[model samples]
Target: METKIQKWGNSLAIRIPKSFAKEAKLDYNTEVEMTIEEERLIIKPVKYKKYKLSDLLKEITKHNIHKEIDTGQAQGKELL
Candidate 1:
């Protein structure tokens, strides 16, 4: 697909069509790396580490558990 380059705040910008964006898993605030290869502009999504709650929980043990902290006396109605 051909996309026209438009002026965007003193820089040239091109809009990626929805179909292409979806195929590349691009969404709002997604980080992408841009480079030039063989006189062609290449845009690739930066892979981000995805964390799962269950996987994180498996690493916790009694040896690494933190003790409770004391904040002196409560200033509000938290005592109630």
Candidate 2:
């Protein structure tokens, strides 16, 4: 498959085919890692580390204190 490098507002860009993108599971706003080697342009999807809420909360200590803000009246099961 061949694609054309077109002008994109003062920058040159290449359009990835929808079929290829779908096969590679690439979607809008997907982060990719691009590199050039031996005159070849390689684009790979960036693998981001997934973290759980519990893992993130463990990183927070007393050094960064997050104060709760009052959001007016309480509703349902909430204790005053």
Candidate 3:
């Protein structure tokens, strides 16, 4: 489980073993957050909340819904 830091272009990189990556649920192109603690580096997945249509609709109510605004007739060529 020991791996050396290799030079990746101008930055140093460490390879995460397949077994560790699989256990951490890390995949190709997966968003991750990296943070450094007192003496350790922490890497975690950046999980985003997926919103549903019904869940979004619930946020719109009479108190917060916008009313239709009446703009005067357009004088320019708007028929097209």
Clashes of each: 0, 0, 0
Candidate 2 local distance difference test against the native: 0.90
Q: Highest TM-score, which number?
A: 3
Q: What is the lDDT, from 0 to 100, of the residue 50 in candidate 1?
A: 100
TM accuracy, model 1: 0.58
- For 23-53, candidate 2 gives per-residue lDDT tens digits of 8888999999999999998888999899999
User: Cα RMSD (Å) per model?
Assistant: 4.3, 4.7, 4.6
Residue 76 of candidate 1: its Cα lDDT? 97
Structure candidate 2, residue pairs in collision: none
RMSD of 3: 4.6
In candidate 3, position 10 carries an lDDT of: 100
Candidate 2 residue 59 C-alpha distance from true site, Å: 12
Q: Residue by residue across 1-80, what tens digits does model 3's lDDT show? A: 67899999999999988899999999888899999999888998998999999999999999999999878897899767
Runs in model 1 deviating more than 4 A are 49-80
Model 3 lDDT-worst window of ten: 70-79
> All candidates' lDDT scores?
0.91, 0.90, 0.91
Candidate ranking under lDDT, highest first, comes to 1, 3, 2
